[model samples]
Target: MKKSSLILASAGALLLMAGVYLAFFVAPDTVVRIDDRELVQFSQKIFYFHVPVAETSFVFLVLGGLFGAMFLGTRKRSYEQMSYAAVEVGFIFVLLVMITGVLWTRAAWNVWWEWEPRLTTFLVLTLMYSGYFVLRSSVQEESAKARFGAIFSIIAAVNVPLTFVAGRLDSLKPVHPKVFTLQGASMEGPMLAAFLVSMFGMLLFATSLYIMRLDLLRAREDIEYLKEELEVG
Candidate 1:
């Protein structure tokens, strides 16, 4: 491995360990109550990972779109490769979001699922990116696949913003009361720290994943090229 890769791998592993420590040990407790009865305390602890993964997924979603735009502008395969990596990373984070969100619902809402806007939006996110992968696979030609996939990726990512907007358009359905409530109020100290740590950890993890995946992809491409050269020779 190159020195940069080795250094980054070491740093990423350290950060991942630190994040685990901060989350399990340093993070404060969360409590949920009804009529002065403590129904959930430590159960709410999962919120730290849930919200952060969900938010980090959003960051990657936008990043994929930006890379898609760059691919179109530059007509380069590298940008397409980077965009593909970002989308894959984004999908993993989205899955984490769904898993954590379900846990939170079971803990706080006493139900395994709810038709909340955020939840629905995340579901849409999963589908949109899934379509990206499908579209890529359907094309047999490499250059054509990359070209068309870039277009589809850009379009599919638009659903993210649309899904957010659609959530607001629905005024009648039951929505999570987030306006001026304790929910939206500034997160307290330990809670804030836990949240920040979770987000930063996931973002760093995603970055590391992107680098590793990209390197593997480039290596595969090089191998394929060498094989083709040998066959011709």
Candidate 2:
């Protein structure tokens, strides 16, 4: 990889570190609507980082799939490695998103795991993409593992949009109470700045995580190749 890409990866890691602090300490507090007649007070600040990170996770997930598809089309190992790294990082972000989302849902919606469209779809997406790893494990042959992993990665990518749309087909979409307003005093300047910082950090963290994984995978392949050569000699 170029020095610039390496710098970007390092920068992303630094951002993630900054994001964690901003998210926990700097955001505002507010009341969240749980149901038609119920409301619960929550830290208003988490919304900025939580919502943005969730969205960013999905974005990375899609990018992962795109790289996966590109790998298939070009039959280039680098693209394949990139796709694999993307999915690994995407998975980590998705898990974080799910955890934070569940906490928010429990406080706001009064349920641990609702069958709401987005939530449900995310669950499915998690399982399917995770299975991509399992599928790779089941194959013993080198070529077979790569081919299957690539194929499943593509399929999982295709399902993301489909699941997102399916998850939103419910009756209880976001109402007015949870919505932020400029005229109202919900989020002001300081809170917004903190929120933005947190978001940027999370995005940076995800990028760095992916870069690390990609390099690790490439190194593993190289080692495996050397081992085979040594054994043959």
**103-220, model 2: which lDDT tens digit per residue?**
8677665678666666677788778877988897899987777777778888888888888886666567653243433333655666666666667766766776677787789899
TM-score of 2: 0.78
Query: Lowest summed-lDDT stretch of 10 residues in model 2?
Result: 175-184
Backbone clash total, candidate 1: 0
Which candidate should be chosen as best, given lDDT against the real structure?
A: 1
Each prediction's whole-model lDDT (CA):
0.77, 0.72
- Mark the regions of model 1 whose C-alpha exceeds 4 Å error after superposition: 1-6, 38-40, 176-186
**Across residues 152-227, which tens digit of lDDT does each residue of candidate 1 receive?**
7788778788998897789799766431223745477766776676677667767777787788878889999999
Off by over 4 Å in 2: 1-28, 31-40, 170-191
Highest-TM-score candidate: 1
RMSD of candidate 2 to the true fold?
4.7
Please give the distance, in angstroms, between residue 99's alpha carbon in candidate 2 and its true position after superposition.
Answer: 1.5
